[model samples]
Target chain A: MFRDIAEWLANSPAREFSAGLLSSIPGLPPILQTVHLLSIVAIMASIVLIDLRILGLAVPSQQLDEMIVRLRAWTVWGVIGAIISGILFVLARPNRYLLNPVFQIKFILLIGVLILTVCFYRWSAKNPFSHEPGNNIGIAKGVAVVSLLMWIVVVMAGRWIAYSEYLFWPG
Target chain B: MLNEFFLWLEYLPLAQHIGATWWFPLMESLHVVSMTLMLGTILMVDLRILGFAANRYAISTMSSELVPWSAVSLTIASVTGVAMFITRASTHAVNPALQIKMLLMVLAAINIVTVHCYVFRGVVNWDAGKVAPFSARFSAGCSLGLWVGVFLAGRWIGHIV
Candidate 1:
């Protein structure tokens, strides 16, 4: 079922147009890749600081709300940038990525991390943390650790997609 | 000059071994991971100093908390980066993107020293939620720009080479 969808999307008009245009432009792919990487850096930075705080390893004196408020915009922008650039990247080489196992894993992890981030945000909102560090330190630390692990997997899978031996489906 | 040194490095047994095997990929992955960690921590500190984020936190405290991790990652990144460089010394030595990356890193290092030695001495006055003084803000701005440039240049190296 998933392969059928991928195959259908690969032959779609939008994909064809995007791939043609992206390839015709000189340096677009690399520029998009660079943007994608910078976005990843920004996303990781915001999440790492937040995760470290939740783990009680950083900025212990500052209230969690203050840190989150400041970093929220950065985190949002990073997510938006990543998704936009990531889509364009896939559009450029749909067939190559659709069948790639590493790409498939990365796509799944991306969805998982997105869901995890939403849950974390909801949790933080409901239980506002201050300088007291809270009685639920263990739960907060668990969330942070899980978030960090999910993102690490996502990043590794994305990088390894290029290095993986399998790039295409057997016709 | 250092061209001869770079040439000598290219023939080193470690360099050859890394180039001939999976070591290159492994080291490359480690290098990227280290760079990400180092840059992420540095960005946090710089963001705090620039009065852009984490304003409630004391700048001194943020520095003390984050800079050590940044330093550790920088050490790892430097080691992995030099290892990769030695494997293709002649090529990287002349690569424009790499040259720019190294020079920008040096500038960033100098900026770090200048900030810590001079601007940071008076940080007690503005360590809290107060906006950083112009000199400190300027240093932070430079640090952010230089590090971003370093990352871009580093990424561009693969394309250029």
Candidate 2:
């Protein structure tokens, strides 16, 4: 079923146009990859700050609510940048990404992290620590750990995509 | 002279082992992970200092908390980066992208030193929610740009080498 979806997407006009354009341009893949990496830096920066705050690891003087408000904007911008660049990257060579198990795992993990991030944000908004500005309890720390670990795995999988030999049809 | 040193280093047992074994990928992954951590923390603190993000926090507070982690990451990154370099010392020595990357890293280090020596001396004066002075903000902006350049050059190294 996944292969069917990948095949369908690969044959889509948008993907075809993107692939054509990307191929026609010299160094576009590397450029897109660099932009993708830059966006990752942005996202990771904001996410780390938030996670550290939640874990009671840093920024003890600042209120959690205020930090969240400011960091959220940066995180959202990072996510937007990452999504656009990532789409362009995948569109450049759909088969290369769509057919790779590491890519698939990375995608799954991305969705999981996104969901976890959203839930954590909502939970933080309601929690007392967000307003009170102090050490977070057990659950918040757990969420922080999960958030950090999951994202680490996602990035590892992303890098491994280049190394993975298992492909849908073999490159 | 440096090229000679690099060539000599390349033939060492550890370097040969790194090149021949799976250690290459492992070290590369470690280098990248450490880079992410380092860049992420530095960007956040620099942005905060530039009054672009995290303005609610004090500059001193953010710097004290964030810089240490970035320092740790820098140490790890430098170690892994050197390990990876020793494995392919001769090739990397002539890679233009790598040369540029190294130069930019030096500039970034100098920028950090400038910040610590000049801007940070007066940090207490502007440590609160206020925007940092022109010098501090300028240093922060430069730091961001330099790191981004380093990252771009780092990526370009693969294409060249």
Best of the candidates, TM-score:
2
- Residues A95-161, candidate 1: write the lDDT tens digits: 7787778788888888888888888777777777754455656788898998888887776667667
Instruction: Tell me the tens digit of each residue's lDDT in model 2 across B61-141.
Output: 888888988999899989988998898898998999899999999999999999999789978788986678999989999
For each prediction, how big is the interface RMSD?
2.4, 2.3
Off by over 4 Å in 1: A24-26, A130-135, A166-171, B1-4
CA lDDT, every model vs. true structure: 0.81, 0.80
Itemize residue pairs with steric clashes in candidate 2.
Answer: none
- Residue pairs of candidate 1 with colliding backbone atoms: none
For model 1, chain A alone compared with the true chain A gives a TM-score of: 0.88
- Quantify how close model 2 is to the true structure by its C-alpha RMSD in Å: 2.8
Model 2 TM: 0.90
**lDDT for position B39 in model 2:** 89
Predicted candidate 2 versus true structure: per-residue lDDT over A22-83, tens digit per residue: 78987776677677777777777778667877777766666766777667876788778778
